[model samples]
Target: MASPTAAPALRAEHLTKHFGRTHAVEDLTLEVAAGEVFGFLGPNGAGKSTTIRVLLGLLRPTAGTAWVFDAPAADVERAHRYLAHVPADVALWPSFTGQECLDLLAGVGPGTDLVYRAELVERFGLDPGKRARAYSTGNRQKVALVAAFATRAPLLVLDEPTSGLDPLMEREFRRCIAEATGRGQTVFLSSHQLAEVEAVCTRVGILRAGRLVEVAGLAELRRLRRSEVAVELARPQPALDALAGLPGVADVRWTSPLELTLALTGPPGPVLRALGDADVVRLDVREPSLEEIFLDYYGQAAA
Candidate 1:
């Protein structure tokens, strides 16, 4: 369990980064609490990678500060002692075998549980005897993931770690993250996979055009989503002018003389009452998925 008095695992205060005339990340401020799994989300070109580079001390911030385990990010050597990082792209010396790569990373990282590392290698279905040059993209990713998960560092920073993984491997990745958090390790997960984030993160932050647009728990975000509703009338339906005017109803359309489809965004009371007046034969309400909600945010940002 994380100590209540322990400082946050990661913190950014008014952080910004720029390249020539372009602002990559602008005035971003957020904190990842000890033992928290935070999802950092953004569309491509939204500064997610830039913000991470600053946090890793690979790039000096144009303004403000980033800290890891209470040490300034600029002090990479010290700050890195408390964390393990897995980048979107994994590169390895072509001559080294998978086992050799794991050994090398463990030797340089904070610390490693060799026993657990062995288990991860098996679970990820990696052939440790293969040389790096022969490994496929997914297999190379597995090597990096295994190395990071085997570490005893208090924080894990993953940037699109599952990009090369197949569905089964992605599930294994989520399981590993769960186990890490269970051991009181903090996780900063930057991913474009909304379903993955929805499955694992305790909270999520959405970024757009170098700015932090919103930060909220999954449940809170779900509340803002619209539900898809399809209703079938048993008989010729009454005109739906009143239903169209209902507070939360939108995109009302009659697909056929007996069927109506609409989107519901808020309280269902009024809409339900209006539906009750019709000769309702069947009704289906499907909740919006995380991907839909994410796209909604992106669309709104674009507009």
Candidate 2:
């Protein structure tokens, strides 16, 4: 495990990156703590990949600054020593075998556990003897994952790391993330998959277009979004106006004379009690998914 440091794993202060008239990443400020999995959530073309490239020193920030373990992001030689990265689309030397590629990476990177790398290779179901030229997209991704997971670097930056993997492979990816954290490594994950982000990330920062619109813990985010509740009654509900007036009920829809569905935010207790004596034949409550939550909050921000 890499030694713990007081500095955050990553920091961006009013960072901006632009291409001609287009702004790829604009005025972004964020921080990721050491030893925590922080999800960078955004859709494709939302500047996630651009932001990552700047952080990796592959592209210079047009303004502001970025840091890795207190080392300047533009100082790749120095900053990279403290972190390992896996890109969304991985490319390898076609002539080299998967094992050879892993070996070359370990040779150039900070350090690696050959034993752990061997295990990861098996777990990810990679054929190490196969030449990279013959490997499929998923196999190439697996090689990158294996290399990053086995590294002793303090921080790992993963961009859409599970893009081409199977469901079972995705599960293994989650397990690898858990093990990385257990070893005290910080992870900065860039992805748009809400379920994937929710599975391992404690906190997420949502980016829309080129701007960051929201940042919050998973629990906090869920609490701030609306939930859907559907209730069917034996008879038409009386005092419909009164139920709509209840606190936390944002929207009330009468699907039929006897059915009431509501968009609710905050505590459900108030909404539940308001349904008393309606002879509810069916009741269902559904929490807002992260995608729905994103639209509810940042859809306007995009405009």
Candidate 3:
């Protein structure tokens, strides 16, 4: 297990990367502790990939710096020694069998555990005898995932790692990630699958147009999201005009004589107290999903 005082597995301080005219990432600052599973979320062209490249030492920041295991990200050779990366697009030598590909990656990457590698192969259901040319897009992704998971690197940087996987495979991927974190391995996952991130990540960072917009635990993010509240009153429907004016209420609508639906964006205390005064028959509060929260952030930014 990693020591509690050990240096962060990954850290970025005011990191920025710019093209001739495009700013791919800007002043992004965050840290992933030694054993955390951190999710990096952004829509396409939101700088998720750019940030990952910077962290992997594949691209140097135009400003500021990133570090991996205390080594500067620009020092690829040293920082890479402690990390493994799996890109969204997986490409392999067509002539090499899956087993051969794993062998090659293990030899070049931080060493691998044969037993764990074999287990991953079975878990992901990759056929070792099949050459890369015969594999499907999902199979190619599986090869990279298995290889990364099997390695002994202390940090795993996965970019859209489940892009081509089906539901079952995605579940398997989450399971693997959970196991990795359990073993004290830090994971920096860049993905569009909000549910997947919510299921596996300890914390998540949202990026918008190359800037870090929000970073928080899943529960906290949910709290910031709008909740869908529906209430059905029994007989005396308490005056709802006042309910509509309650704190945190929005889009108040009367769907039926006794039913009310509203968007709640803040604490439920005020809304609950109002409902309590009525002969409430049923009250259903649906927490916002990660995707909803993500869209809300973007919607607010756009507004």
Cα lDDT tens digits, model 3, 197-287, are 9899989999999999999999999888789999888875758768878888999998888888999987999988877778888999999
Sliding window of 10 residues with minimal summed lDDT for model 2: 294-303
- Scored by Cα lDDT, where does model 1 land? 0.90
After superposition, candidate 1 runs with Cα above 4 Å error: 1-5, 237-240
Query: Model 2, range 1-303, lDDT digits (tens) per residue?
Result: 464468889999999999999999999999998989999999899999999999788899999899888799999998999988999999999999999999999988889999999999989989999999999999999999999999999999999999989999999999999999999999999998889999999899988878988889988998898888998888776776477888888688887888878888898888777777668899999987777887765667656
Report the Cα lDDT for residue 128, model 2: 97
Please give the TM-score that candidate 2 achieves against the real structure: 0.93
- Look at candidate 3 and tell me the lDDT of residue 189: 95
Query: TM-scores for all candidates?
Result: 0.90, 0.93, 0.94
Tell me how far the alpha carbon of residue 209 in candidate 3 is from the true structure, in angstroms, after superposition. 1.3
Backbone clash pairs for candidate 2 read: none
lDDT of 3: 0.90
